[model samples]
Target: MQRTADRLLREPLDCYDDGAIEEGDLSVIRLALEQFHHAVADRRAVIGTGSTDIPPMQARQT
Candidate 1:
Protein backbone atom coordinates (compact mmCIF):
# COMPACT_ATOMS: atom_id res chain seq x y z
CA MET A 1 0.00 0.00 0.00
CA GLN A 2 2.87 2.33 0.77
CA ARG A 3 4.37 1.45 -2.61
CA THR A 4 1.04 2.13 -4.29
CA ALA A 5 0.81 5.51 -2.59
CA ASP A 6 4.35 6.36 -3.67
CA ARG A 7 3.66 5.31 -7.25
CA LEU A 8 0.47 7.38 -7.47
CA LEU A 9 2.31 10.44 -6.19
CA ARG A 10 5.38 10.10 -8.37
CA GLU A 11 3.84 8.80 -11.60
CA PRO A 12 1.30 11.60 -11.95
CA LEU A 13 3.97 14.28 -11.74
CA ASP A 14 5.99 12.46 -14.36
CA CYS A 15 2.91 12.14 -16.57
CA TYR A 16 2.05 15.85 -16.22
CA ASP A 17 5.61 16.77 -17.11
CA ASP A 18 5.40 14.74 -20.30
CA GLY A 19 1.90 15.78 -21.51
CA ALA A 20 -1.74 16.43 -20.53
CA ILE A 21 -3.65 13.82 -18.48
CA GLU A 22 -6.83 12.25 -19.86
CA GLU A 23 -10.09 11.27 -18.10
CA GLY A 24 -8.90 7.69 -17.69
CA ASP A 25 -5.76 8.89 -15.99
CA LEU A 26 -7.78 11.15 -13.69
CA SER A 27 -10.06 8.24 -12.74
CA VAL A 28 -7.10 6.05 -11.89
CA ILE A 29 -5.56 8.82 -9.82
CA ARG A 30 -8.78 9.30 -7.87
CA LEU A 31 -9.06 5.58 -7.15
CA ALA A 32 -5.45 5.40 -6.10
CA LEU A 33 -5.98 8.26 -3.63
CA GLU A 34 -8.99 6.48 -2.13
CA GLN A 35 -6.93 3.31 -1.66
CA PHE A 36 -4.13 5.31 -0.09
CA HIS A 37 -6.60 6.93 2.31
CA HIS A 38 -7.74 3.52 3.50
CA ALA A 39 -4.16 2.36 3.83
CA VAL A 40 -3.32 5.31 6.09
CA ALA A 41 -6.34 4.65 8.26
CA ASP A 42 -5.24 1.06 8.71
CA ARG A 43 -1.72 2.15 9.61
CA ARG A 44 -3.01 4.64 12.14
CA ALA A 45 -5.01 1.90 13.84
CA VAL A 46 -1.88 -0.24 14.22
CA ILE A 47 0.34 2.62 15.44
CA GLY A 48 -2.29 4.26 17.66
CA THR A 49 -1.99 7.97 18.51
CA GLY A 50 1.41 8.97 19.99
CA SER A 51 0.15 12.33 21.16
CA THR A 52 0.55 11.39 24.83
CA ASP A 53 4.36 11.24 24.43
CA ILE A 54 4.63 14.90 23.45
CA PRO A 55 5.21 17.59 26.10
CA PRO A 56 2.70 20.40 26.46
CA MET A 57 3.71 23.68 24.84
CA GLN A 58 4.44 26.63 27.10
CA ALA A 59 3.09 30.06 26.22
CA ARG A 60 5.62 32.90 25.88
CA GLN A 61 5.00 36.35 27.35
CA THR A 62 5.28 39.30 25.01
Candidate 2:
Protein backbone atom coordinates (compact mmCIF):
# COMPACT_ATOMS: atom_id res chain seq x y z
CA MET A 1 0.00 0.00 0.00
CA GLN A 2 2.82 2.36 0.78
CA ARG A 3 4.41 1.31 -2.48
CA THR A 4 1.20 2.14 -4.27
CA ALA A 5 1.06 5.56 -2.68
CA ASP A 6 4.66 6.19 -3.62
CA ARG A 7 3.88 5.21 -7.18
CA LEU A 8 0.82 7.43 -7.32
CA LEU A 9 2.86 10.40 -6.14
CA ARG A 10 5.63 9.65 -8.58
CA GLU A 11 3.32 9.12 -11.55
CA PRO A 12 1.78 12.58 -11.42
CA LEU A 13 5.12 14.29 -11.12
CA ASP A 14 6.45 12.24 -13.96
CA CYS A 15 3.49 13.03 -16.16
CA TYR A 16 3.71 16.73 -15.42
CA ASP A 17 7.41 16.85 -16.20
CA ASP A 18 6.89 14.83 -19.39
CA GLY A 19 4.25 17.24 -20.64
CA ALA A 20 1.60 14.57 -20.63
CA ILE A 21 -0.52 16.55 -18.22
CA GLU A 22 -1.32 20.19 -18.62
CA GLU A 23 -0.71 22.57 -15.74
CA GLY A 24 -4.34 23.72 -15.75
CA ASP A 25 -6.01 20.31 -16.01
CA LEU A 26 -8.35 19.89 -13.09
CA SER A 27 -9.25 16.36 -14.19
CA VAL A 28 -5.69 15.23 -13.90
CA ILE A 29 -5.42 16.79 -10.51
CA ARG A 30 -8.57 15.09 -9.37
CA LEU A 31 -7.37 11.76 -10.61
CA ALA A 32 -4.10 12.17 -8.79
CA LEU A 33 -5.92 13.15 -5.63
CA GLU A 34 -8.19 10.14 -5.87
CA GLN A 35 -5.28 7.80 -6.38
CA PHE A 36 -3.51 9.29 -3.40
CA HIS A 37 -6.58 8.86 -1.28
CA HIS A 38 -6.87 5.25 -2.31
CA ALA A 39 -3.24 4.58 -1.49
CA VAL A 40 -3.64 6.10 1.93
CA ALA A 41 -6.76 4.10 2.56
CA ASP A 42 -5.01 0.90 1.59
CA ARG A 43 -2.14 1.60 3.95
CA ARG A 44 -4.51 2.43 6.76
CA ALA A 45 -6.39 -0.76 6.08
CA VAL A 46 -3.28 -2.84 6.41
CA ILE A 47 -2.46 -1.27 9.73
CA GLY A 48 -6.00 -1.56 10.98
CA THR A 49 -6.18 -5.24 10.08
CA GLY A 50 -2.90 -5.95 11.79
CA SER A 51 -4.01 -4.31 15.00
CA THR A 52 -7.69 -5.35 14.76
CA ASP A 53 -8.83 -1.78 14.82
CA ILE A 54 -12.16 -1.23 13.10
CA PRO A 55 -11.86 -4.35 10.98
CA PRO A 56 -9.41 -2.90 8.47
CA MET A 57 -10.13 -0.76 5.40
CA GLN A 58 -13.25 0.59 7.01
CA ALA A 59 -12.01 4.14 6.83
CA ARG A 60 -13.28 5.88 3.77
CA GLN A 61 -13.87 9.29 2.28
CA THR A 62 -17.36 10.35 1.36
Best by TM-score: 1
Residue-level lDDT tens digits of model 2 in 22-43: 7675366556666656666677
Task: Report every candidate's CA lDDT.
Answer: 0.59, 0.59
Clashing pairs in 2: none
Model 1 per-residue lDDT tens digits across residues 1-62: 65866675777756755666654665666665666666666676778943323233332232
Model 1 spans > 4 angstroms off: 1-19, 50-62
Lowest-sum lDDT 10-residue window in model 1:
53-62
**Clashing pairs counted in every model:** 0, 0
